[model samples]
Target: MPSLSPSSGQSGLSGRTPPSPSEALTVYVVDDEELIRTSLQGLLRSMQLDVRTFGSAEEFLAAPKVAGPACLVLDVRLRGESGLAFQQSLAHRGLAHLPVIIMTGHGDVAMTVQAMKAGARDFLEKPFRQQEMIDAVIGALEADTRRLAAERSLDELRSCWADLTPREREVLGHVAAGRMNKQIAGDMGIAEITAKIHRGQGMRKMRSRSVADLVLKMQALDVIRRAA
Candidate 1:
């Protein structure tokens, strides 16, 4: 196994701010070599990042899930299962959302292409510079953070959608489709004032500031679709 000790090079993480415990991020390292694991653990811990090490892919999978955003730093070669195969199996293992950084002692252009195709966030050759590893981990964490935020936003939007009454949804849909209140009332066979009331309530429930905003949210929720 290639030694990835950070002591040999300057670390860029020293002056960075660490996240609080509640919002802490994690980095999982899966490598068969004990020295590599220990070195990485020490280096990341100095920066106050939560780091976990596993000897094999199976070990990491069997471990309990950690809360908050995290990324995986995986060695390409392992005793039991190669990192390439494990990376490909992440989606099947229900870890498709997890970002991965691939590292190898022996790397080739073909191997790098394969890892990228497998959705790895980065690839590093062994004996790589310490700053390179740190940069990759930081990039992966940033990407995961954006992904989690989008997921949460979608969930909240879905919850808001579920709270809407059927009539309210219909009114909102008409508005999204560019119908006026009178037109909506005609479409739903309801009074114009009733249509206006439902439109107001629906917009309030969806927390929309304007008709255009409502339309955008509706599109996001698939309440309306643009022409192909």
Candidate 2:
């Protein structure tokens, strides 16, 4: 298997329209065979895409991690690590946002079902047309873009929460849990006037003008519940 960098074999993609700056996507190919790897690399390049290829799962993982919008075209049968196992490992390492399109010459109904259940973006049998691979790559890239956007939105929500004072944070939690000002005061053992003040401060800092807005923001930030 040959290890091709992103810069090599990219000329063929000259005619293919590239995504806008805000939409550019990276497509990575991982396979154990040199021919298959290069073939996919060329195919994607011909479409004016940014493509990279790795000889094995380990090689792919060892490469510098990319945080921008991207997707993977992975083979199910690798020399050392099975594609399914690698997918699981990516999930365990918190890299599941990188959408995977699993390809195999030995695909079965059961294996395809398992791949989908494991969060694969798509599964294609070997001997697929170039167009099929291209479509899958495009779909996976779009999914990754949406996922990254959602993460950014959540991060902003967390930052908004972080700006709150301790008392405001306490009030935020109470409000998010459906507590009225009077109930929140009772729970905090504070005067209703004080509770109202804290709640208003928290709402302002969180940029939430209403109770529903506060609840939605908290849910988006994944702060409503702890993992027990």
Q: What is the C-alpha lDDT of each candidate?
A: 0.87, 0.81
| Alpha-carbon deviation at 14 in model 2, angstroms | 15
Tens-digit lDDT track for model 1 on 44-73?
A: 777678999999998999998776889999
Q: How many residue pairs clash in each candidate?
A: 0, 1
State candidate 1's TM-score.
0.93
TM for every model, in the order presented, reads 0.93, 0.76
Model 1 residue pairs with clashes: none
Please give, for residues 11-109, the per-residue lDDT of candidate 2 as tens digits. 423333434546556888888899988888777877767788999987887887667788898999999989988987887777878899999989999
Model 2 TM: 0.76
lDDT of 1 at 124: 92
- Compute the lDDT of residue 89 as modeled in candidate 1: 96
lDDT of 1 at 183: 99
